[model samples]
Target: MASGDLAVGVVCLSQTVVGLMGNVSLLYHYLFLYFTGCRPRSTDLIVVHLIIANFLSLLSRGVPQTMAAFGSTLFLNDIGCKLVFYVHRVGRGVSISTTCLLSVFQVITISPRNSRWGELKEKAPRYTGFAIFLCWLPYMLVNIICLMYITGKWGNTNSTIKKDLGYCSGEGNNEISVSLCVPMLSMPDVFCVGLMLWASSSMVFILFRHQQRVQHIHKNDLSPRSSPESRATHSILVLVSMFVSSYILSCLLQVCIVFMDNPNILAVNASALISVCFPTLCPFILMSRVSREPRLSFAWIKITKSPKPIINM
Candidate 1:
C-alpha cells in the first residue's frame, strides 16, 4: 500500500474505533441510569437517540471508507453497497433531526413561564419519544432510493455514467432522477439545520438577557457559578456550533464531489473524514458536560440515605 493510503487508513481506523467506544460507553451509562430507576432529565431521551444515530453513522461510513482507503477493492457486493449507503444516509439524517430536536427541547425547557414558548415547555417532554420516532421515520423511508442507484464496484459495468465511490458506484445517467433525489434528500437536512440555527440563536439571546439580570442583581460579585440551565444552554450552543461547522464543510466537499467530472481519492477521503467529525466528537462533549455537573451522577453503586444496623450479624 502507498504511504498516503496507509496514513488515511490509520486515521479512519482511529476515528471509527474512538467514536464507537465513546458512543457505546455513553449509551451504557444512560441505560444503566434507566435500569437503576434513576429519573432521567427530559433531554436525556433525545440524547440517547442521538448516541444511537451517531453509532450507526460512524459504523456504516467509517468501516467501509477505512477499508477502501487501505486499498481494499471489490470487498462489498451489490447488496452490501446498497445497505451500507442506505444506513449511512439514514443515520446522518437521524443525527441531524435528533440534534435539532434536542436544541428545540432545551429552548422549551428554559423559556420563561409567561412567554409564548411556556405552553410548549409543559408538552415537549411528553412527546419526546414521538418526536424521536418522527426523526427516524422520514430518513428510513426516503433513503430507500439508495437501493436502486447504488451498486458495488464489480456490479458497475458502465464506467462512463457511474460515479465511482471507491467501493461502491452510484448511477449518474439519469439527470432527472438525480435532480429529484438530491432535493428530496437535502430538504429535510436543510430544514433541520435551519431550526437548529434558530434554536441556537434563541439560546444565546436568552443567556445574554439572563447574564444582564444577574449582573444587575449582584453588582459587587464579579463572578458567580452558572445555573444548570445556563450550563446546559452553553453546552448545547457549543454542540450546535461544532455540528454546523462540520456539516457545512462536509456539504461543501460533497458538492465538489458531485460537480467534479472525477473526484480524486484525497477529496473523497477528506469528505468522509469531515462527515464523521461531529459523531466522533459529540459523545466526548456530552461526557465532559456530565462530568462537570456533580448532580448528574453515574455511580455504579447507589448510596442509600439510611443504612441498616450491623448488630444483627
Candidate 2:
C-alpha cells in the first residue's frame, strides 16, 4: 500500500520480466539455427531439449509471477490460483527431471568403451523418455492435493498478504497445510530432488575425470578437432551447475525465511527466477570456445590444401 512497497514490487517484477524475455529469445534463436538453418550436429538435439525445459519453466513460473506482481489484480479466483500454481509447480519439477536426464545422457555418451559405463550408452535413448515420464508422474499426483488447498482467499487485518495477492494458508491451519498435505507431498519432493542431486553429483565427477584424461591426450599429433562429446558435456555441466547453485542457495534462503519470519518475498522469487537465465548463458559459454575467424580460416586452408571438400558441400 505504501509508496516504498510499490517501488520494491516494481523493481522485483521488472527483473523477472527482463530476464525471462532475454533468455527465451536467446534460446529460441539457438534452437532455430540448430534445428533448421545450421547443420545437424551431435550436441544439437540435447541442446534443443535443454532449451525446451528452460522455455517451459519460463512460461510457467516467470510469466505468472510477473503478471501477479505487475497487474492491478491477483489470482481472481480458485481456478486462477490453481492455474498459476500448477504451472509453476509442475514446470519447476520438470526442470529437475530434465537436468538429471541431460546429465546421465552426457555421462553415457562420453563413457569409455570396454568399461561397464559403455553399456548405458547403448540404452540411453530408450531410458531418457522413461526417466522424464517417471519424474512427471509423481508431481502430477502430489499436486492434486495442492490444487484443492490453494484457493485465492483474500487477506485480512488478522493475517497478512506478502505482497499484493494472497495464497491459501494465510491463516495457517496445522491439519490442512502442515499435517495432511504438506507432509504427504513433501515426501515425493524430497525423493525427486534427492535423486536429481545424486545424479548431478555423479555426472559432475565423471565429467572432471573425463576432462583430466583429455588433458593428457592433447598433443601435437592430436587433431585440431575437439571431441564434440566433451563439448556437449561441458555445456550440460554448466547448465547443471548453474541450476544447482541457484537452487541450493534459494533453498537456504527459504529455510532462513521460515525461521526468521521476514516479510520479504521478492528476494526469494528473484533468486529462483535468475536460475532461468542459465539457458541464455549456456550458448554463450559454448560459443566462447568456438572461434568464428579460426573456423573460417580452417575452412579456407582446408580448401587451399584440399579443394575436394568444397565440391562435396
Candidate 3:
C-alpha cells in the first residue's frame, strides 16, 4: 500500500474507534440507568435505539471500509458482503427513522395545549413504541435485495452492476427488481428528512410565539430564559442539520467519483469517511448539552440533565 493509503487507513481506524466508543458509552450509560431503576423517558428510549443503529453502522460499514483501506478489499466472501451491506443500510435507515420520531415527539411535547398534536402528547409513549417497531420493518425489507445482488468478486464483468469494494457487483438480470428497490432505498430517507424539516420549522414558530408572550409579561427583560423544550428543540435542529449536511456532502462527492474517469483512491476513501460521519459525531453533539458536574464516581458516567417536560404536552 502507498503511504497515503496507510495514512487514510489510520484515519478511518480512528474514526471507527471513536464512533464505536461514543455509541457504546451512550448505550452503556442508558442501560445502567435502566438497571438502577430510573425511568428512561421516551426520548431516552429513542436515543438508546439510535445509539444502537449508529454502533451497527460503524461496525458493518466503517470497520470494513477501514480494513479495505489497509488493502483487505477482497477479504470478505459473498455472504459476508451481503450481511455487512444489509446491516449498514438497515442501520442507516433506522437512524434516520428514529431521528424523525424524536423530532416529532419533541414538537408534540412542546406544542400549545389546544393544538391537535398537543393532545396526542399523553399517548406519546405508546406511539413512540409503535414507531420504533415500525422503523425496522421497511428497512429490513428494502435491503433484502442485497442478498441476491451483493457478491465478493474482484473483476465483475457487468457494467450496470454497482461495485462496492469487498462486495461483488449486483447481478444485472434483475433490472426490474433493482428499479423497484431503488425507490425503496431512498423514499424513507426523503420522508424522514421532510418530517425533520417540518418539525424544526414548527418549533421555531412556537418559540417565536412563546418569546412574544414572555416579552409581553416582562417588559424590562429582553433576554427571556429559554425553556428546556426550546433548548431540546434547538439541539435536535442542530443535529438534524449536521446529519443532512453530511449526507449531502457525501452524496455530492460520490456523484463526482462516479463521473470521474479515474477517481483517485484517496478521494474515494474521503467519500467513505464523510458518508458515515453522522453516526460518528452525533453522540458528542448530544454530550455538549449534558451537565458537566459529576454525578457518579465512575469516570464515564456523566449524568445529563433530563429533557424538557414532555409529558405535560
Q: List the residue pairs that clash in candidate 3.
A: 151-168
How would you encode candidate 2's per-residue C-alpha lDDT over 181-202 as one tens digit per residue? Answer: 6567557656646766666676
Name the better of 2 and 3 by lDDT.
3
Residue 242 lDDT, candidate 2, scale 0-100: 74
Give the poorly placed runs of model 1, Cα more than 4 Å off: 155-161, 298-302, 306-313
TM-scores for candidates 1 onward, in order: 0.92, 0.68, 0.82
Ordered by TM-score, highest first, the candidates read 1, 3, 2
Off by over 4 Å in 2: 1-53, 71-75, 153-171, 175-180, 187-189, 211-226, 253-313
lDDT of each: 0.85, 0.56, 0.75
lDDT of 1 by residue, 1-313 (tens): 9998889889989999999999998898788777756778889999998998998899899999999988887899889999999999999999999999999999998888888999987788789889999999999999988789878886557766457777787666566876887798899999999999999999888888778877865677676678788888888889999999999999998877776656777888899998888899999988877767654453333534326542577
User: Highest TM-score, which number?
Assistant: 1
lDDT of 3: 0.75
lDDT of 3 by residue, 268-292 (tens): 7878788678899988876654333
Cα TM-score of candidate 1: 0.92
